[model samples]
Target: MRNDRTIKWLILLIPTLTIGLWEYIRHAFLLPYLSMELGNLLAPFIVLAVTLTLVRSLFARLEQSQQALQREKGTNAALEERERLARELHDGISQSLFLLAVKLDVLDEMKIDGPVKELATGLRETVRVMHEDVRQAIANLRLPPSPAAAAWVVPLRELLGETAEMSEAQADFSWSIPDVSLSDKEKVELHACLREALINVRKHANATKVLVVGEADGFGGFRCAVEDDGKGFSGDPLQSPGRFGLRMVRDRATAMGWNFLAERRGDWTIVELRKQGGAAS
Candidate 1:
């Protein structure tokens, strides 16, 4: 920022100072041999030379700084994204591994009269779930970083498309979002939330068509929704057995400092995520 300010000052002051000095010289000294008319005629050329020599150089330097800043920002964002993905992988595997160990310990400590078959079945299920989690994490790791060169919503479009195919639902998606509305971290969280919402729609909502829409809120904020025309299921996360996915999404929203809404609006089941203006993005 300091460099930026200095460059701007140079851009403005170089021309103004040059013209002022030239005028003073033209009147006070050049007026004798360099006539008033000749000095007047040469003023434009002097200014042009100063602009080309000093101001133009400053402008190029300023542009280079801007490009450097952009590159730095992209690098930082990429690092942050990698860190977040690593955390996701670690957390998922650690929790499942810990649970698996606990189950194993219980089985090992069981008595002859214990429910050994039941415990075995539970252990098998846990292992299956852990396997799936590992597979998913590996797949996520293989995905390239968010394409900065393309629209950020490109991945979301593919996700929704897959949801549509898997659920046999016609999905309609649209967005009108300005750039910088979501930071990379916020985008990851939003993607997870939307993925969870779509999973709920596919597994629970018996809908024929789904609408996913995102838009700038006209206040430097953004909102997106996944709405399905199906039998919307609703319950308190604490009391609902099938609402675990929504619970996970809601937890993620809270973590991201965003708003989460899941409700039945008339005939549509709506799952919406929103973040207000002045967010880190």
Candidate 2:
């Protein structure tokens, strides 16, 4: 922006200054040695020389510098977005495959006749669900970035609905956040964290129902979560086989100075993201 302004100002000022200085010098002191007709011809050539050697070159260098800066910015943005997608893949798709593999290995080890057919059918369903997830992720990643997008609740609601549809689970989202509660980037980041949580629920939770809730208070603090009535493990979910996605969600929240937790609350497995402090709601 600064460079653009400088270029504009120079484009207007340089020509006028050059012409004025040349005319003044020619008329003021050269009148004795030079005739009016000769001075007139030399005046144009002098201005042309200054323009070609100085103004043109200066503008060319400035434009080249500007172009370089733009290219650098574009490269940085692309790299950042690529990293974001890589994280998503590691957390979502990779973790899903890991769980699928674990389940299959367990099923293979079991020689029971009755449950073998059931386990095989379940594994097939899991594969089909994963295929749907990958397709949905590709469609989402292809969308252009939009900072001035709709309110946070819109996409989150749609995502929860999709998760429910794919998993054949009951899903509901309750949002109490006003439009002013979160900035654009905050909304985007929180949405992504919640997405990973939902993916975990869909792939590994074996949930029959899902509930997502988001709310903000007057103190600029907010809370959000993806909760499911899924099977509970004996230890911390962070130490479980599907920990990769949860850890990614935790890292994202921590980087934003927010709190994240993946744990079982009674019979409910809740993955929560929160920020406890800021300006008055």
Candidate 3:
């Protein structure tokens, strides 16, 4: 509405200003014999030009404002969803998982058959893993979609450390992140892909040690690698059954415009992800 009023005023003033300027030039600067014909002929064209310029400027500003509003709307929606997810995980899954783990621990203490006791122990271990996963989910939800590298580094290392301990494997984590910006989607996919890789190690790789490395490209990109000393794939991991998790990771990397590679180098199985178009720091 404001823009419309400004445009309307501009349109009304264009002719008035053009006519006045013409009359001033004709009467104040010219001889008495000067013809008003030229002034009359050019005044409308001058008015039209001025009107077009003003209209274009107004529309440009309007378009810019519209774009800014849309961006703000998107940001708000994303934040609201993040908060909702955080609350649900904390109040629902996290609490339930914690209670379940406690119950399993109590079951383990009961006097039962050897096999039943073993089963209870196993169940408790599984519950512990599930509880950790729930806690990680809650953490992710609590953090902003695009958080500082430092904010994620400690949590990621702890997650890997826990997974290694569960699998009875040694874990080494190295991170050298430069101050580069990553979009929320990119960060989420990156973390998911790395988690999947580590999961593969924990499930299949009879490895004793795992190495995880991460580094930012310093120009708005980053890379991650998870390497394990395990019995590597013979041919193609992607073609094997029960490898759907890695396939999902590959798809996510592709969607995010990141390079993904999983292969065996000698005795080590390596999975790597690098953001496209990002130069090394």
Per-residue alpha-carbon lDDT of candidate 2 for residues 51-81, written as tens digits (9 for 90 to 100)? 7887887789788888989977986796679
Q: For residues 194-261, write the lDDT of model 3, one tens digit per residue.
A: 88787777767878889999887666667789999888787788999868978998998887777889
Q: Counting only residues 3 or more apart in sequence or on different chains, how many pairs clash (N, Cα, C under 3 Å) in candidate 3?
A: 0
Point out where model 1 deviates above 4 Å. Answer: 1-137, 146-150, 255-257, 276-281
The candidate scoring highest on TM-score is: 3
Each model's number of backbone clashes? 0, 3, 0
lDDT of 1 by residue, 113-206 (tens): 4577676767766566456545555566556565574355676677677768867889898888765656668777777788778767766677
In order, candidate lDDTs are: 0.77, 0.78, 0.77
Error in Å for residue 25 of model 1:
17
Candidate 2, residue 153: how far the Cα is off, in Å: 4.5
Model 3 worst lDDT window (10 residues): 145-154
Candidate 1 Cα RMSD (Å): 7.2
* Estimated TM-score for each candidate: 0.56, 0.56, 0.63
